[model samples]
Target: MSEPTSPESNPHLTLVDHPLVQHKLTLMRAKATSTATFRQLLREISLLLGYEALRTLPLTDTVIETPMQEMKAPVLAGKKLAVVSILRAGNGLLDGILELAPSARVGFVGLYRDEETLKPVQYYCKVPSDLADRPVLALDPMLATGNSSVAAVDLLKEKGAQDIRFLCLLAAPEGVARMKEAHPDVKIVTASLDEKLNEKGYIVPGLGDAGDRMFGTK
Candidate 1:
């Protein structure tokens, strides 16, 4: 796929503009939207995005017996699905996706960037064994500088997750570039692309800290 125009450009992003996602995104963007409302919108939008994310999941045709006769049916192929959330914020998206794919195994990775160093340091990391055998969907709310995200993906790779995709609510141009440079094989799905990251490494015009919004903590 071609690269996105810029960190601020939404044109290159794989945005699921379905009505439900758009509506909730609007609510999430409003300044007056309450913590409760933001949390709800995040869950709703995550589910909608998850639907699009899983569209290309591999499937196999199997013989099945219906009420009257045998028929061929499609079922998810091979290993069960795995959802790896990049900690607190990713958990918001993870919950919604899990509701839709409950059979999927769950994992968590916690890394926080050091503002001064612009590097990610791991605080917690845990993922299911045998990730190489399963399709893994890794999630985080914002892909800004890409430092933390790249680190998260590196950890996943170390664990042998070959089939991995990155999912986010918003992405910045710089972050996308960093991810593409570091992990070109990973597919990215997001709702919108915001302008470049601000001096503090936050996505411009992007939703604020997703973890804070989701948990009602500053």
Candidate 2:
């Protein structure tokens, strides 16, 4: 995929309009798609999104030995990355990103939204101690209300994370607005910016509850 398309509403957001990602996302959105297929498609799309999210990672010049002779090479600079999953749904995207970044340090922040208020409730959080030094990628399949996502980033920031990126399969305008208001400094990488959220805080025209479909849960 080439550079992501930045929307006028939020320049920090990058819409990954890659054809392959859109095609797989369509399959995943179909009501008839199987659980196994949805999971597989999510994994595939995660790799693509991950590619865009880390596209601007800093690089440094270094001397390397080639098959013939030594030469100057550019390589990834800075500390190992921290990939933080926002509990269950985030794990779906986490797997593929880990495959793309095998050496990244993994972390998890458990937060479930309250049905009535749609606010996040945290239960668990265990992240890398060096978050202040390493970049972080926070994962959640749906950026619905951006409640849980904002809460997750709050926790990461409290833990000393300076650089952070939010990753999702689909995002709604309300959620994106919420994220922008709460954490404008963080960049957002998503597959598609869909219509507004429904009355119950679900993304309209979305592929249903990502956690349930991905895990065969409700």
Model 1: per-residue lDDT, tens digit, 1-218?
Answer: 33544534432246666877777887887878888989888988899899888877999999999999999999999898989999879988988999989999999999988989889999999899899999999999999888899999999999999998889998888888888778878878888878788889988898788888789897
How displaced is residue 170 in candidate 2, in Å? 0.5
| Full-model lDDT, candidate 2 | 0.92
- Model 2 spans > 4 angstroms off: 1-6
Off by over 4 Å in 1: 1-13
Task: Return the top candidate by lDDT.
Answer: 2
Question: Residue 116 in model 1: shift from native, Å?
Answer: 1.8
What alpha-carbon RMSD in Å does predicted model 2 have with respect to the real structure? 3.8
lDDT assessment of candidate 1: 0.86
Best by TM-score: 2
Model 2 over residues 65-125: C-alpha lDDT tens digits?
Answer: 9999999999889999999999989999998999999999999999999989999999999
lDDT of 2 at 45: 96
RMSD of each: 2.7, 3.8
Work out the TM-score per prediction: 0.93, 0.96
Q: Provide backbone clash counts, one per model.
A: 1, 0
